[model samples]
Target chain A: MKQYKHHTLSVLVENKAGVLSRIAGLFARRGFNIYSLAVAPTDDQKFSQITIVVDVQSAPLEQITKQLFKLINVVKISELDPATSCEYELILAKINAPGNNRASIIELVQLFGGKIVDIGISQLTVMLADSPTKVDDFEALLEPYGIIEVQRTGRVALAKQETSSAKLRSISGKVS
Target chain B: MELTGAQALIKSLEAQGVEVIFGIPGGAILPVYDPLIDSPLRHILVRHEQGAGHMAEGYAHVSGRPGVAMVTSGPAATNIVTALADAYMDSIPMVCITGQVALGSIGTDAFQEADTTGITMSVTKHNWLVTSAQDIPRIIKEAFHVATTGRPGPVLVDIPKDVSNQLMQWYWPDEVDMPGYKPTVKGHPKMIKQAAKLILEAKKPVIYAGGGIIRAGASDQLKTLAELISSPVATTLMGRGCFPDEHELAMGMPGMHGTYTAVTAIQKADLLIALGVRFDDRVTGKISSFAPNAKVIHVDIDPAELGKVRHPEVPIVGDVGYVLTELIKEIKNLEKKQDQSDKSAWLKQIKDWQIRFPLTYDKEQTKVIKPQFVVETLSANTPEDTIVVSGVGQHQMFATQYWKFNRPNQWVNSGGLGTMGFAIPAAIGAKVANPSAMVWAIDGDGCFQMTAQELVTASSEKIPIKVAILNNAYLGMVRQWQEMFYEERYSEVYLSPDLPDYVKWAEAMGCVGFRVESPDEVAIVIEKANAINDRPVVIDFRTDSSEKVYPMVPSGASNDDIVVDPSQGQGGM
Candidate 1:
């Protein structure tokens, strides 16, 4: 089987303009096929957090990470495993509904454990939380109803509570 | 008592005895520049802000002083971040300053405005956004103090545009006070005694010196200790040139691409006394099997790094220079005995490996030449004490494997970052630091293409550093992979199309140039490059594209699994 690559990058960037563009350009120029990207503020005394997800084998991913670390703004890069972390995504969608079909949209939203955040006479807005891939599936489900304005907060993750980076200190067992 | 914050800043730096600063002129930092124009402090205007950062790094490496870099806000600060990270990783002392938008307009996104404090947090040992004009003197003092003290690294001070321009009462306090910051000065006496006891008791002990030796300015002390113990010494890649490489006990770099002698010596040691060096993965192959039998004593300045990797039997945490001072005292207390563990067996094994797969380039069968010769001859002709900088790749490996580096810090490469285009500019920095010593840039064709523009920096400054380009017409590492694993599906490995004739390129930059086609010409051209003392010289050797770095541990592979000398089928034991 061909080895698909997975990269977990921990970026410490200033929460400001053009940073996302710089990061995206870095990935696009380097030929990294980003599978998922997670951005959030960290609990540090300074700086914000950005997590990039790229699909490639370990060697190329290592190369990507090394290159990314060399970027002037990239503070740190760590390849995190999905198994060790819980990942989530949020998606907002607007679907046009003329009549009784509008109730179907509301029922579908409730069925998927979502909520109607906004409503208009011609269009209804639904918000859902799931995996990014699942968000894609939700977008697909609302396609026939002429869905519009799809906004996704890409994958955000927090490693399982008990096993902190402190716990990971002894991965090689040669130290701590 | 009356002074501008800018004048106060300069006075504080001068009081700190700052002789020089590396920087470029910019708008936001005009206040500091205006004051600097009249100060006794010498300023070297580097071509780029990034160049200033690396120049500071080189100066710091040489002087054991905190090198200072100044820049404007925004891209300038960002540009210096790599050098900041470089110093952070290697524990070099550097003070970086950037002018910011004033406090009133800080978050307003004014021209050249950047959140300097936010951008530099993770990359710096400590950073401050100086708000008040009065804080200027204290902050500059603290920045230097923090940057040079224990676990040295880059410290940043972000001065606002107006704050630097503001008038203030100026006084250079003889002492500084930062209540939260006090580094450990003295090592635990018990721990120092324990490390000395371990060294005394062990039959086979090795002192693994690192860049910490350079940072601590303890090369003379390291040499003394190695002689006192009568043990062979090995160093990490970053540790190269810290101890005189020519010392009989000096085994070259140890790790994935380490010399055979160094690796085997490290493996056979019963006790490893690691001083001021981090056990990077490149040095310690799969950590589990690395020096499995050795009882390790790790001496470092940083407490956090202690027990972080390969937990030492004794972790003596404090300044390296201070710890070494105490260790020498403790050694005087121990009873002397004859060295018992016959390192002969281990030494013989390493010698046998070296002889069997001695780094060689074909003397007779010379079609496409070998890069190995370029460095070997360059190493022989250049002063043994000369500094050598390299761009990372196949050539870096060959430089480490083939070149004899008998002294400390003679070899400077972007080890952790493996940065391309690092060689030319880094050599320029090294030359700037040590004006009398010959500096050579051992670069690969691919890496030379990255930042050779720094040739102008060298030529303009008249800081002469010889460049030796290992001109293999391929991305040698990728080509090796294609040959070994991809069934020769060579894609994107050819660099011939993009490469320029380096000789002409060097000439255009107002430097002497030489081109070598055969292995025999390596020494002659290198000698010629060395002879041209007035300007930098570049020598391009057209080497074979297919040559590979031997004793390779496939990424993340265990230490035991090294592929030695692929061309000769001499596999590792």
Candidate 2:
């Protein structure tokens, strides 16, 4: 059996209505799988950045990027490498806590640089923002405590801004 | 100029040089139709939206320009989806504008409300949902640009009814502002040189051409390339007329229903110089074994198509004509003249195959007329410049196999999608495009029933296209499959020949009707149908249903195991 590899792609598109639908429709019709997707407006008002993690077992990365480029609103697709890019995800969770376990949970949160947003009679709402792996570790650690609810925002990534040296081959998919 | 969006729409169409629009007006699209009455552009009202869409497709197939279609919301928009899909599959240039409900009433389930954009997003190359009246002209420009460029597929623009009613200050932009839609029209010089080297070095080369040759107006360039290289050309079904069948080096259409020489030559080739073809499944039976020893040099305008089916040793992405020009130049510069004797063995092999297994049908059946006979007789009687259109099924295969097409755009059929109801309206549209040329539609009993009502439109419009319905009394292709694979337990495939008297139906549609039961009357009625220049004519030629397309590579089978007529026993092989 062939292993299906997962790749994260950062795409810049003209910010407008139904652009997401167009991208989603392309994926669906082409039978490409979406592992995770994050969409947010860029610093510029006219363009938006979409970070998509795809798991298409049958298609290659070049094919996916080529199909995306066919869409009129899609401007650029950048393949974000985990080795050089900064990838982050946010997780919000409420853990069932008694008064005695509250201090230990707070200590764990402080150690991980997370913040306790609210304290309830029997629960504590914790907010953690970090790399996807770290967020997963945090979720695993909090599973010991009775969990009330959990929410996670899909990953958003950007390439590292480095001026030290430029490499001959960049990580961007196909073309800008 | 200050104008309503509907008025500006007409003006934009006029600016775009769209001479005709095929559509049917309803509540949502009433505003767009209102402006058409005053505009100089002609509008042919169709009975169904599907007919309008197919008519545009046929018009585009013949004229090499983007055909235009407009329809109302909901069912009308949905009805046109088949044509959109068909055009998309064949990469026909078409612009379809569907009217939507008011902006505010959208998603409220108002009357005739449908998510037209969402429904058509997958089928269309690009589509726009216009919210403001000011964006109409720009979107229309972009729609035409997108539909007629790159691979040339259908595009749709869904406008709200209120947006059409609103007034706007209209100014046609000089250039479209689509940053992401720049299509590469020129091949890389280095790649062209590499391809030229491959062409010169190959011992056995086959030029497999597709509809892209006609779309890019590259038939002349392809012919030059084929003749200069001494490579035999095998055209796909959509590429029927690109290479003249009379040319000695021309191999006929290749695939399931292709000629024997074409199928055998491709299998034995050492190199395939594929241009503007996607290597469709029908063409490549069992992809793994298709052209087993061939190193491919694939060129197409669409990048995704280059490696979608068959990966190429030299993948060149550019317009077909431009690539052919560059390739021809590079080949000429690389070598002053191609050594003709280098490929003598390959050429001789193709010639031998052509002589051994010519496309043949039993012509002595006196009780029943073979469908191929009807097609051949029609081919013999029609003018050289006549545009041949066909519906899907066994009739389509026979139409393409028998017709001797020598010029580009002289053959039109639903190649990719195999839309059943395509022939009637498409013939109407083709005749409209080439008013001086005689257009003939060869149809089947099953397919003609799908869009027969469009004859009414053709008759009323005075576009005289003669049609011959091969009354096989069944879905001929499906029945053949059932007989071969499913023990001949024919399921709902039969449509009795005499159920709907086609002559009466033709007469009711204001067309001159003729019924020919025997083969003796075939040529006489065809001559009569040809002479009628004032209105559309229909002739019902009741044909035998048992006759099937020959030289068939059975489903999922390798091209190596192609079967000839079963009656001609397998003992020879």
Candidate 3:
């Protein structure tokens, strides 16, 4: 049996019409499954960054990267390792906070560093921005409180910055 | 200088060194045509938009330049979709300029309006829709640049009528600034050295060259590498003419319907050096069993092709010519002398296979002309530098099998797409590109009727290419499949010879036509057709309808299960 794992790739592409569709079409045509996707404008208006989470077998991962590079619109790609990257997801949960469960729900949200963004007569909308694991745990904790609706912004990640000393050492080593 | 968008477009094409264009003008593209009247570029008016696209492909295939095609909006754009798909599949470099409806009425279902870019998005490498006249010069430059670089394929640029009529200051961009579009042209030195080491160590190695060799003009480098290592070379259908067929080490084509020696050599090899080949399904039967014993060294311009189907031990991404040049240098630098005695046995085995099951067909058994005989005879009679083109099917197989291609780009056909109706226009395009050389479109009867209307274009344009129609009176390849697999239940494959007399049809199209029914008249008719240099000529050779392409490996079947002759037995010898 083939083992499947999650991979996060940050793809920088030209900011142009149909560029997104071209990338999506390539993934679809090549039978690569995307678990989550987020696209946003980068610092430079000429380029856009797309963060995609894919569940693929290890053997085909290399091929997927090569195929992504084939798309002319794709500028650069960097595969982020979960161990070294800061990953986060945002989730909005609308829960039925009738009376007794409201206090427990608020307590759970506070524990998970969530905030109550909206309150109604019988419902409370809580927003959580944290790591994927923390978001999952928060969702599970509010499940007993009769969660009415849930929406998740898929995973976005960035590598942790290196120490200034390490960077300076590498620069000096290169010069030597 | 201030100029209309159409004028700027023509000037940009001229600046790109475009010598000719293939197209048919219509209402949406009338503005572009007005400027074309005074331009120095020659335009061959085609009967169908698809013909224009295919003509451009043929010209590009031989000239190593991006061919240009122009057409109007809606139906014209839609008609050229097949050609774009063909070019895409084959990785031919082409630029298709399509006229779109005015910007104001783009989505309003205006007359002659279609979503040109939307329909062609997947088929083309990249496409654009120009909303402003100022964008014309840059778009044209980018289209050519994108189409001709990195794993070349067709690109389409659609200009609206209003945009074409708009005025703008014309200036060509000094450089294309696409950050995402850099293609690696040189292979890594370490990988090349590793590949050379593998080549030097292997006892039985074979070079599997493909269409990329021709595209990169790396045939000379390929030959040098093969000679340096004393290895046999086999070309895929797309790589037929990349190596001279007459070379001693040449194992003609390998795969279904390929020469037995070529197919067996690849199957039995220990190391396969695959150059610019995608390991297409047709070339690698039952991928699991294909070259099972071989550790492959795959080199190509497209990184996607490295492990798409078959994984390679060494995957080098670069242009074929550059890689081969580096590889040869690396091998020389390594100072590894290949033991000729170690490979003598392998060469002997390949030669034995070649002598045992050479490409042969029964010609003397029947009075009716065999298609192979026709192809063989035609190949023998043609000039040394002749360019042979063919449509898809039995005739295509026969031409690829029997024709002795002595030079690169000498054999042109739709190898990847298997598109019929490609021959007539493609031959004209080849002739247009090489006016002094002989160009022949060897086609089947069924395929001839598809785009035969292009013969009129050839005649009117004064491109006198020769057409050899193997009149088998049926869809030969499909009929053969039905005969072998479907219990001989012949479907709607037959076409009566007398229904539409090919000779008469050719005459009607202002071409000199002749008919040959017997073997005795084949040479005479071909000679006569070759002599007529003023107008396009068509020779209808009525070949045996029952003739089938041999050396068959049923689709999805292993190469070990190849049947040399179905009449003898279904079992492999």
Cα shift from native, residue B512, model 2 (Å): 0.9
Give the Å error, residue B51, model 1: 1.7
What is the model-wide C-alpha lDDT for candidate 2? 0.91
lDDT of 2 by residue, B121-231 (tens): 999998999998899889999999999988999999998999999999989989999877899898877788889999999889999999999999999999999999999
For DockQ, candidate 1 versus 2, the one ahead is 2
lDDT of 1 by residue, B355-416 (tens): 77555545456565777766777777877678878888899888877778776657777777
lDDT of 3 by residue, A1-176 (tens): 33338878999999988888888887887788888999999999999999988777633777788878877789999887777678899999999998878888888889888999999889999999999889988999889888999999999999878756774554522000
Note the residue pairs that clash in candidate 3.
none
Query: Could you give the interface RMSD of each candidate, to one decimal?
Result: 10.5, 2.8, 5.8
TM of chain B, each: 0.93, 0.98, 0.98
Which stretches of candidate 2 lie above 4 Å from their native place? A1-4, A162-164, A167-176, B336-341, B567-573
Which sequence of candidate numbers ranks them by lDDT, best first? 2, 3, 1
Global lDDT of each candidate = 0.77, 0.91, 0.90
lDDT for each residue of candidate 3 in B1-573, tens digit (9 for 90 to 100): 999999999999999999999999998898999999999999999999999999999999888898899999999999999999999999999999999999999899999899998889889988999989999999999999999998999999999999999999989999898888899888887788889889888889999999999999999999999888889999998999999999999989989888777888888899999999999998899899998999999999998888788988998989999999989888887764643337888889988888878888885665899999989989999899999999999999999999999899888899998999999988988888888999999999889999999999998989999999998889999999999899999999999876689999999999998999999888888889889999999999999988888888788999878878544445353
lDDT for residue B145 in candidate 2, whole number 0-100: 95
lDDT of 3 at A131: 90
Model 3 TM-score (2 dp): 0.96
Q: What is residue B571's positional error in candidate 1, in angstroms?
A: 3.0
Clashing pairs for model 2 are none
Q: 1 or 3, which is superior by lDDT?
A: 3
